[model samples]
Target chain A: MHRIRCPFCGARDETEFAYRGDATKRRPPDDADEDAFFDYVYRRANPKDWHVEWWHHTGGCRRLVKVVRHTVTHEVHWTGWPDQPPSLPDGAP
Target chain B: MAITVRNGVACCLVLARRGFAEVTAERLELSLEPGRATIGAERCCLPIAPGEWLVLEQWRADGGLRMQLEGDAAGLAYVSDQSHGRQVIRVAGPAARDLLGRGCRLDLHPRKCRPGFCAATSIAEYACALVQVDAVPSFDLVVAAGYAESFWLWLTDHAAMFGYRAAIETVDRP
Candidate 1:
């Protein structure tokens, strides 16, 4: 069983949570073009190395949390709030 | 920081009931009961489909039993411990419907989320559980426990705005 650490509830089994997509998303500027807005809302780059993931703490806390996990190893790099940036690997591609 | 029991109304329940259990293709079976999950024969009888069973431990994935669970489990996919990390808020009374209107997006109708059904969704900007506790319009909100205090405040604050009054009530697993 995969045990995930909920930023609010400590380490818990994966079931008590919901897996949202990547946590890292660009915030379109107020005066950005339609294309930029569409990209921010739709397009995404699924990188392999240290990746940012969005998670919903469905078990207890309702706040959206961001976790940095390795896509391959599934090892958590770090977990933080949505505004926080995910930690990157050395010379990440 | 003070972990205030904000309202002296929360109740701890003796939730000793069988939730859900499953057996995987690996021939691994799992069960989520009240206290904890264990492989094979345990003292308490489970009125469930015959298979492997494990009680849902409302604690962290650590220590002896956890290790047993790790080894015995086909995977942690079957048993879930959604109780610990999240706050469970219960909002009852006639105005319960009105109170939930502000944040909940799912259909709050009784038939939609009837008894014995669980909805895993969000309310406003928070993760929440909407259960119809009473036949006569009472409902419960099982949310991330960490945000319990805030949601409680929000519920009451908006409840007042919605002409509804609420108090903390204890929630136990049965």
Candidate 2:
């Protein structure tokens, strides 16, 4: 079973969290072109290695956290506040 | 060992304004640490989140802690009186940990979760805020009012194996 280390509630089972979509998706400016907005909302990269995603600690702190994980192995490398970027370690893939 | 469940206690959900958690904590003179509670003679302040605390106290005709919080820190926080919206149950016994472990995932080991520790999680499919009140291996579970009946039934049913007794008490004033 996968466990997530919640900054506020310590490590807990992943079942308590809700997997939000990709955290790497950035929203386009309101004045941006239609295509840009479309891609921002609908397009997402499904990477096999390190990928940033969002997870909501619904059952615990009720906060959104950004997590870097490997898609194939489901290994979570790190988790932090949604507004902050995950700091990758040296020589990390 | 005997397990006892006490139902109905006054509670309030206090949400601090952004960047004002410390201000609110100062006003209440309570610690705002996650997974812990600061107990006073008449009240218990539990920090359920970074900016949220669950204040539990016995009901009083003068409004008790809710009155004091509003009178002092209304500008820095939003206090929602949950006295009627939630039901508080205290479970204590030698088998308390075993019974709670059936639904709770938190490690209830005395060394890991000592007295005054609190957690917001699930129990018997219902959301609950749990607090370890003392070293007697006692715990207080706060569940939504709507689920009170079912949660109570679930608790009593499970507690039967360990031999349990329940008491419904009117709120006490200090």
Candidate 3:
């Protein structure tokens, strides 16, 4: 099983987790019109190299984390917090 | 000394907390390494995926742990120090197997839920964290803290004829 580190609860088994969705994507400014904000929140392009978010220990600590993964290969290069960008190692798939 | 062959230790001092009671117990002298927490307890050397644990300290009517939880709920993680929200119930002294067998689906035989191992099972119509306290098949059940009074009454009322003499215990107790 893949072990993912959470910003709040440290590393936990993936079984106690749920994939939240793309992490790096941000919504438009809060001042933006309501319709535009709704579109930004709902619409998303399934990109190949995307940042995925995951929640660990749902019943316990309830913290979310991001994983830099390939959509096609389902391979994750690295994981980090929402504010931090995932770092890719050299020649990583 | 009772010899146990298992993955974790049956700590003499079990801390059982229920709903919002703030269950936080500091492991004494546990060695924390870079990525893992190691304990040289009598039963197991705990070092695996996570450093966290479902500590099985007994729940007492005396309120030693309850006072601690109420005093410092902010310092400990909400998962552990939820004494106000959950109930810490003790199921030990021989008939524990029979008491638990009526509810949980897990096998309480020494070959399965042996000393040092903890299981998350359903009891009292809700999910609970159950731990093996001894090889003879005693268990400590960590239930939601809100149900503490009801659970305590259940064990005392139902577990009497089955050979359980309701008594308070600590994790340090052997």
Candidate 4:
């Protein structure tokens, strides 16, 4: 059972949060070329190691949070507000 | 020994804009801090977020706390009268924590979540703002109006084991 410690609502069951896909993906500037926009919208890397993802605390604070987790082990390193930077996990490259 | 549910307390939600905490504090006459509540003579203000607070006061016949706050701090904060939008239920008794623990994930232990601690969490599938009101383990649950009836039913059903009573009182603001 995974429990996420929400910055606003404290620790809650993982079911309380909805996964919102990759947080590392940045949208291209409006003035950028169509190719850039296409890649930004469609192309995304599925890394095996530590990756940042978006999780919405739908049941609790109803706010979006950025979660850094290890894809292979399903170990969450840190969870923080989307606008804030997530702390790096120990021993992470 | 008994569980009591008190319904219809007046509540107000205050959302302070960026860099407006000082103004809010001055206007509301309560120091604001996340996860902590400042109880005054008339009302209690619980800072649920960095810039958000839930002000709880006794109900009155005339437009209660909402009107009072809007009249005082409408320019400094966004004041919404949640008296009707949400139903305030006070659960007090020796088994209050045990009853709440059936659905809530929060640690209701006096040491960890004593008086003045408020949180937004789920209670029996309904989103609720749970506030510890006193050391008697009394809790005030602010639930959405739409789910209030059903939530009350669920609570009463569970509280039957502990001997519960429902009371609807029109309390005057002090």
Candidate 2 structure quality by residue, lDDT tens digits, B1-174: 343344336788888999999999998876777787898877888888888999988676545667778888878998888887888888887889999998888898888889898999888668899988888888988888899888989988888888887877654545
Give the candidate number with the greatest TM-score: 2
Docking class of 4: medium
Fnat (0 to 1) per candidate: 0.07, 0.67, 0.00, 0.43
The candidate scoring highest on lDDT is: 2
**A-chain TM-score of every model:** 0.81, 0.90, 0.66, 0.90
lDDT of 2 by residue, A1-93 (tens): 678888888888888889998888888888999999889988887677777888898887799888887788888889888778687656666
Residue A19 displacement (Å), model 2: 0.8
lDDT, residue B87, candidate 1: 56
Ten contiguous residues minimizing lDDT sum, candidate 2 chain B: B1-10
On DockQ, the stronger of 2 and 4 is: 2
In candidate 1, what are the lDDT values of residues B15-106, reduced to their tens digit?
12233233431334332332122223321111121232223223322343334444555343334433345455556566666667677654
- All candidates in order of DockQ, best leading: 2, 4, 3, 1
Candidate 3 at B15: error in angstroms? 15
How well does candidate 4 score on lDDT at residue B171?
50
Comparing 3 and 4 on DockQ, the stronger one = 4
How high is the lDDT of residue B29 in model 1?
Answer: 37
Off by over 4 Å in 1: A1-93, B1-21, B24-84, B162-165, B169-174
